[model samples]
Target chain A: MIDMLTNILQTTVLYSTPLILAAMGGLFSERSGVVNIGLEGLMTMGAFIAAITSLSTGNPWIGLIAAMIAGVILALPHAVAAITFKADQVVIGVAINFLALGLSVYLVKFMYDAGQTPTVQKKLEAVAIPGLSKIPILGPSIFQASPFTYIAIVVVILSYIILYKTTFGMRLRAVGEHPHAAETAGISVIAMRYTAVLISGALAAIGGACLSISIGSEFNQGTVAGQGFIALAALIFGKWNPFGALGAATFFGFAVALSLMGQLIGLSKYVPSEVLSMLPYVLTIIALASFVGRAVAPSALGKPFEKGSR
Target chain B: MSQLNKQSTIVTALISIFLAMIIGSIAMQVAGYNPFAAYQALFVGSLFQAFDLGETIRTTTPLILTGLAVAIAFRTGLFNIGVEGQMIVAQLASLLVGIKLNLPPVLHMIVAVLVGGIAGAIWGFIPGFLKAVRGVNEVIICIMMNFIALYLSNVLVRNWLSEQGTDSTPKIPESASLRVDFLSEMFDSSRVHLGIIIALIMAFVMYILLWKTKRGYELRAVGYNPSAAEYAGINVKRNIILSMVISGFFAGLAGAGELLGTQGYMAIQSAFTGIGFDGIAVALLGANTPIGVILAALLFGVLTYGSQNMEHVAQVPPELIRVVVAAIIFFVAANISGILLGAVKKKRRAKES
Candidate 1:
């Protein structure tokens, strides 16, 4: 029983790491007043690029960096459209997702003559902490993880600190809450928003890299498979807080792990596997419907910050 | 001024399409393919070829309804991203009714189609109610709902609806089928059917509902400014729900068009048909107008239908068409007209000075 519990816990962390990273990215963007539905596409690009780079260079870290760059590059168009041109943020986000989907598939087909890239030569290997990974349950579950999992944990901590304990964080929040006021206070709303959005893209890319190089070890047509959107849902369920996002993502990850385990343990004979697979989405809907009204957004979230406009 | 605005919008849409084609050509060239030859093949396959034209129209049938689904929701200030989910649910509902019932031909068809609409409306109502009553973001809820609907439909198909040795339900009864003999004959025995006619009629109905009815005015008013509409005695909450229901209704019809007209049965979908996501592009390119949706759907139809020929003749990847569609969506959603019109007005002012 203890062994089974440890295994399940390990699986949960593995599943949640990407979601935590992406949700943290979403937290920064939304807390800074931008709605980023393009995380899905950004992750797709990251996963594809990471797989290709890791496959070629035989190094997952380099692939991770390349994934972040690809993400930022893809995000530039969204920034230009939503911030510079004042397009509807949601519409621009939808377009970006479509663009990412098409561009990645097109590139893959062009490069590999297939819909997916070849599996990476080097995947991010699990790191067993000295002496810690041997502990009965807690150690193995927490200490034996890929470098990306540790990085995701660090990111969640750093995001919380940056968002709640820094001057820049305060300014970002101010810009999100009231851009006009932020501008009156001499803050450059456009620059702040641009920075936040770019950070979001970078972090989401890292999450994508985690999926392709760490979890799946390859970039397929379904590598990112709505994980970005699931991360978005986690961000919303977590009320846009880094810690909240972490908890929500872990819960979703647990749900996913349970579904897999249930199927493995022959629970599918009793409860249909499809229903188990749907647990996370159903939970997200319930969480959103229950909390959205109470969990207030940044006052100026999704509104374009125009200079000299009240 | 309205006429000039309309003209400018059209010009901007054309420019966007032109830019996408240019980019697509460059991509083709980079891939060691001939762009002009690929485009020629695309045009011939989608337009000049008789059977392909029928295929284009056949593809256009579902797109028109889905586009209208998105368009109606957009006009009412709701983003119904769950059109795909609603359509899936509707497809299942239509399949169940179409296969289970043994009614006479016309009544059975109508009943199947109506059941699809009702099922979609119910699927749509959840997010709408959550958004209206609980202030949840409809986009997120809709996204979640889509996964739920997908899994639910998968379970249903696997356990209850699946025919022996196949992942599809049994063929719908002839009475429930939307295949029209004359229409198929007209299209050179292609898959064209009564669905296109129904789609066109729905477009007309949408136009009339949106522009010629008081409920539409209320919906639009609520969309434009909910607080103001509420102050002016419009039921904002009710309109939100109503708009979603209507949007889902159209989405349901889209599913019926596919199941009854094209496929004659529901197959378990491994992935989304992408018709719903494409509807976002269709609605945007059409400027959320009913007639514009038809035109935009036809354009998309040509691209998708033509892609096969492009692949066969020029060895261009069909995925390139998707890239082109994405570019078109980006340009349109970014308000290409706003920049061009501003440039044009500046030029005029300079000339006057």
Candidate 2:
């Protein structure tokens, strides 16, 4: 029982790492009043770039950086369309997803002469903290994890600080809440939105890199499948708060961990594996409907800000 | 919301398509392929040969329905991303009905189709109900529901529907099948069936329903401006649910047509069929009209079926078609024609100054 508990906890944290990172990314963009439904695409680009770069350079760190850069590059069209062109953000997001999948898959086949990238030469390694490694059940699970887990935790804390404590954060929130009012106060709403969206792209891509480099060692069509949407769910369940999103991501991770490990732990005797596989998605719907209550979005969410119009 | 005139809408669509084609050519050049030859292969492969044309029509049939599914939702101010999931559930339902039911020939097919559509409506109703009553965002819920439907369908297929040692259900009964002998022979034994005729009929039905009916007027009003719709005494919640149900019904029918008309079995799928996702592109390109959806569906059908020929004949990857489609959607969403018009007007004013 103890061994199973430790295994579940460790795996849960592993699964949660990417979700936490992506949820934090989503929080920033949504807080800045741009509904970024393109996180999935951003993560796909990140995963593809991370694997390709890591394969070529034999350096996982460089791959991670490349992934972040790729995410920002991919997000440029979304930013231009949503902010400058004032296009429908949802439609732009859908287009982003299609473009990301198409471009990545096409390039992958072009470069590798295959549908998927080969495993990277170097992968991010798990690190075990010396002192914390001795703790009974918690030590191995919490102390030993991929570096992305630590990064995700740090991002959550940093997000909390940036969203609630800093002056820039205040202005960003103000812009999202009331762009006209923010403009009246001399804040550059467009700049804030652009910055937030770009940051979202970078962070979400890192989350994608976590999947390709940290957990898995390669990129494929399904490498970042649906995880980005799960992250979005986490952000919503977290009620757009930094720490709340982290907790929500962890819960989703736990659900996924349980589903994945249920067979290994001999729980599949009672439930079908397919049913187990559905746990996270079903839990999300239930959480959204009953537990999370009503999530109030940013006032300017999904709205194009006109300079002089209501 | 300012409605563009019909002429401008068509112009915008043409410009967007042209721009996307140019982008596709640039991408082909970057990838070391000849764009003209690749396009030629694609067009010829999908349209010129009888068998390929039949296959294109077969591929286009379900797309038309899914496109209509999405277009109706868009017209009613909803983004029905769950069409994919709804279709899956509907396929399962239709498969079961097609396999187990003992109804007579025509009745069995009708029953299977209706059951499939009803199943889809139920899937759609969840998100619609929540959005209508609880003020929830339908998009997120629809996405979540899609995953649930996918898993549920997989479980049902493997556990109950499939024959022993098989990953899919048994072939559906001939009574429930949509294949017609005459149509098959006309297309050189292609799988094209009655689904095309049904799809075209639905498109016209949808057009009449939206333009000539009072309920559709109310639905459109609610979509146009909910507050105004409420003030005008339209039941916004009911319309929301009704629109979703109607959209889901067609989504299910798309699945039924694919199964009963072509595949005739339910296989455990590892991933989405992508028809639903493509429906979004179709609706956008079609300008959310029935006639436009049919045209857009044909375009997508050509691209999808023709891409294989591009790969076989010109060594161009089939995935390039998706990039081309995405670029088209991007241009459409950005209203590239409007921007060009603005630029031209600015140049004229500069000359005057």
Candidate 3:
């Protein structure tokens, strides 16, 4: 039973890392006043580029960097359209998702003559922390994992600090809550929003890199598999707070792990795998419906700020 | 000025399409393919042949319904991303009714289609209710509901509805089928059915409902400004839910069209049909107008059906069609033509002053 518990805990962490990273990314963007429905596309770009770069360079770290850069590049058009042109953010987001799906598949087919890339030569490997890893359940679940797992945890902490404990974070929140006021206070709303969105892209890309390099070990059409949306849900469920998103993501990861465990334990005979797969989504709806009333959004979220406009 | 505004919108859509074609050509060139030949093959494959045109019409049938589905919701200020989910649920419901019913042919088909719409309404109602009552973001709720619907449908198909070795349900009885003898014969025995006529009628109904009815006025008013509409005595919450139900009703019809007109059976979908997602593009290109949806749906149908021949004759990847479609959407969403028109308007204003 202890062994089974440990195994499940390990799987949960593995599953939650990407969600945590992406949700944290979403937290930043939403808190800074922009609604980013393009996280999925950004992640897709990151996963594809990360896989290709890791395969060619034989360096996972280099691939991770490439993934972040690719994410930022993909986000540029969304930023330009949403911020500068003041296009509908949701429409731009949906279009970006479609574009990413098409572009990635086209690139994969072009490069590999197939719909997915070959397994990378260099993948982010598990690092067993020397002293901490020897501890029973907590150690194996938290300390002994991929470097990306540690990075994800650090990201959560850093996000908390950056969002709640810093001047930039305060200005970002101010901009999200009331861009006009932020501007009156001499804060550059556009620049703050741009920075926030760019950070979101970078973090979301790292999440994608974690998927291709650490979890899946290859880039396929399904590598991102609605995980980005799940992250978005976690963000909403967490009320757009970094630590809250981290906890929500971990909860979802636990649900996913439980589904996998059900298969292993022959629970499939009683409950279909498809039904099990519905758990996280169903929970998301319930959580949103139940918590959204209390969880207020940034007052100026999804609204475009024009200079000297009320 | 209203006429000019409409003309500018059309011009913008046309420009976006033109620019997308250029982008596609550039991509083809980079990929070492002949763009002109590929486009030529695409046109010929979809338009020149009678049978191919029939295939295009058949494909257009579902797109018309789904496009209207998204368009209606958009007009009501709701983003019904769960059209895909609602369609799947309705598809499954229609399949169940299609296979299980023992009524006369016409009544059975009507019943099956109605069941689909009702099932979709139920699916759509969840998120709508959540949004109306709980203030949950409809987009997130709809997105979640989509996954739930997908997984639930797959389970239902696999455990209860699956035929012997295949993952699909048994062929739906002829009584529930929408196939029409004369239509198929006219199309060189293609899978074309009466669903196209139904879709056209629905488009007309949509036009009448949106423009000629009080309920539609209420819906539109609520969509434009819910708080103001509420102050003006419209039931904003009710309209929000009603809009989603109506949207889901059409999405359900799209699913019925697929099952009755095209597939004839519910196969376990390994992935989303993408017709629902594509509906967003259709609605955007259509300017959320009923007549525009028909035209846009036809165009999308041609591109989808023609991509196969393009791949065969020109050796271009069919994925290029998707790339082109995405490019068009990018340009449209960014309102590239709107920007150009604004520039023009500004120059005119300066001269007038």
Best by TM-score: 2
| Model 1 whole-model lDDT (C-alpha atoms) | 0.87
Question: Candidate 1: interface RMSD in Å?
Answer: 1.4
DockQ (Cα-based) for each candidate: 0.72, 0.73, 0.68
| Residue lDDT tens for model 1, A184-216 | 999998888889999999999999999999989
lDDT of 1 by residue, B1-353 (tens): 11223465577678888888988898888888899999999989988856788889999998999999998999888998998999899999999889887899989999998999889889889999998899877888888888888889999999898988999888998899888788778778888878898899999999999899999999889877889999999999999999998999999999888888889877666678888888988988888888889999999999998999998998787889888998898887777656777799999999999
Question: Which scores greater on DockQ, model 1 or model 3?
Answer: 1
Residue A297 CA error for candidate 3 (Å)? Answer: 1.7
Model 2 misplacement above 4 A: A291-295, B1-7, B349-353
Stretch of 10 with least lDDT, candidate 1 chain A: A287-296
Off by over 4 Å in 1: B1-7
Error (Å) of candidate 1 at residue B107 is: 1.8
Provide the TM-score for each candidate, comma-separated. 0.97, 0.98, 0.96
| Model 2, position B177: C-alpha lDDT score | 93
Q: Which ten residues in a row have the lowest lDDT in candidate 3 chain B?
A: B1-10
Which digits, one per residue and each the tens of the lDDT, describe model 2 over residues A185-228?
99999999999999999999999999999999888889888888
Q: Write the per-residue lDDT of candidate 2 for residues B1-353, one digit (tens) a residue.
A: 13334346777788888999999999999989999999999999999978899999999998999999988888888889888998999998999899888999989998998898899899989989988988777888888888888889898898888899999899998899999889988999999988899899889989988899999899889878889999999999999999999999999989889989989998888878889888888888888889889999999999999999999999888889988998988888877777887799899999999
